[model samples]
Target: MKNVEIGALILRVVLGVTFFIHGLVKFQGGIENTVGWFASIGLPGGLAYAVAIVELVGGLALIIGLGSRVISALLAVLMLGATLKVKLAMGFLGNGQGAGYELDVALLAMAVFIIINGSKLLAVDQRFGKRQKSVAESV
Candidate 1:
């Protein structure tokens, strides 16, 4: 595969696995705790559940290269929200108090890249699209 395609695949897998673990941790920590944390930050507590489910499902979709653009878009939004809501005041570096927005910004940028360039290598999207095109041509 081309270097660019391989790079995209690597990015996709890493982002996918990262978010998946984050989502899993949220679940293990209890939805109530997640909701409480969200409310502490002034967001609607119920959104925690939605966010958890989206992160989990979106991460899976990204890993498999299915609906990657949509998942990336959603994740980008999530990262933006995290940066603005919780991490912005912490600056770029984390201290003993808490973490900073650096990771959020990086994730946001990567998500945006995936959304724009798309996942094309070793991806279900490629195979599915090609199959659909061939079927359409035959019809």
Candidate 2:
């Protein structure tokens, strides 16, 4: 494959995996706790469970490349929240303790790219989408 395609694929997989793990964390923490955390973060209380569910299910959907456009868009928004809510204080240089906004920014970019370009090559979206067009022509 060409460099750009390879880069896009790698980015998608990495973002998918990273987001999935984060979602898993939330699941392990329990929806009530996650919702309380969201409230602490100033987000609306009603959105807590929805956000948690989205993270868990959406992260898996992203990993399988299912409904990639929608998943990427949602993930992009989530990452944007991270950049705005927490990362802004620490600055782009990170917390200086090896934890930084760099990962958040990268995830946002990857999700945005996937939203625009989609999951190309072989992806679950192909079969899951059930397009009349051939997989290569779906896009």
Candidate 3:
């Protein structure tokens, strides 16, 4: 694979693992607490479940390079929401109250990159794309 393809793969795995672990934590550590925290932050408590599901499923999709662009786009939106709604006030570096938006921004950047370039190396999307192309050509 080319260097860019390798880079894309690395980014996909890292972002996937990060989001998966976070989503898992929300479920494992008690989603109710996460819901409460969301409400406390002026967001609807029910939104927490949607967020968790997206993180979990999206992360897995990214890791497997399935629908990479779409999943990355979703993750990018999630990170943007997190930064704007929750972490912006705390600043980039954060304060005593909580962590900052630096990590969120980084993740967002990665997601955007993937959205633009896609997961080129060892991607299920590539397999499907190639098969579809050949089938169409044969027809």
| Best prediction by TM-score | 1
- Residue 97, model 1: lDDT of 98
Which predicted model would earn the best lDDT? 3
Please, what are the lDDT tens digits per residue for candidate 1 over residues 34-71? 99999998999999998999888888888999988899
- List runs of model 1 lying over 4 Å from the truth: none
* Stretches > 4 Å off in candidate 2: 95-99, 128-131, 134-139
Return the clash pairs for model 1, or none: none
Question: How well is each residue in 45-99 modelled by candidate 3, as lDDT tens digits?
Answer: 9999999999998899889889989988999999999999999999999998999
Q: Using alpha carbons, what is the TM-score of model 1?
A: 0.96
lDDT of 3: 0.93
List model 2 lDDT by residue over 8-54, tens digit each: 67777777788777878877877678778778979876786666666
C-alpha RMSD by candidate, in order: 0.9, 3.8, 1.0
Better of 2 and 3 by lDDT: 3
Task: Sort the candidates on lDDT, descending order.
Answer: 3, 1, 2
TM for every model, in the order presented, reads: 0.96, 0.80, 0.95
> Any residue pairs clashing in model 3, and if so which?
none
lDDT of 1 at 127: 95
For residue 39, what is the lDDT in candidate 2?
81
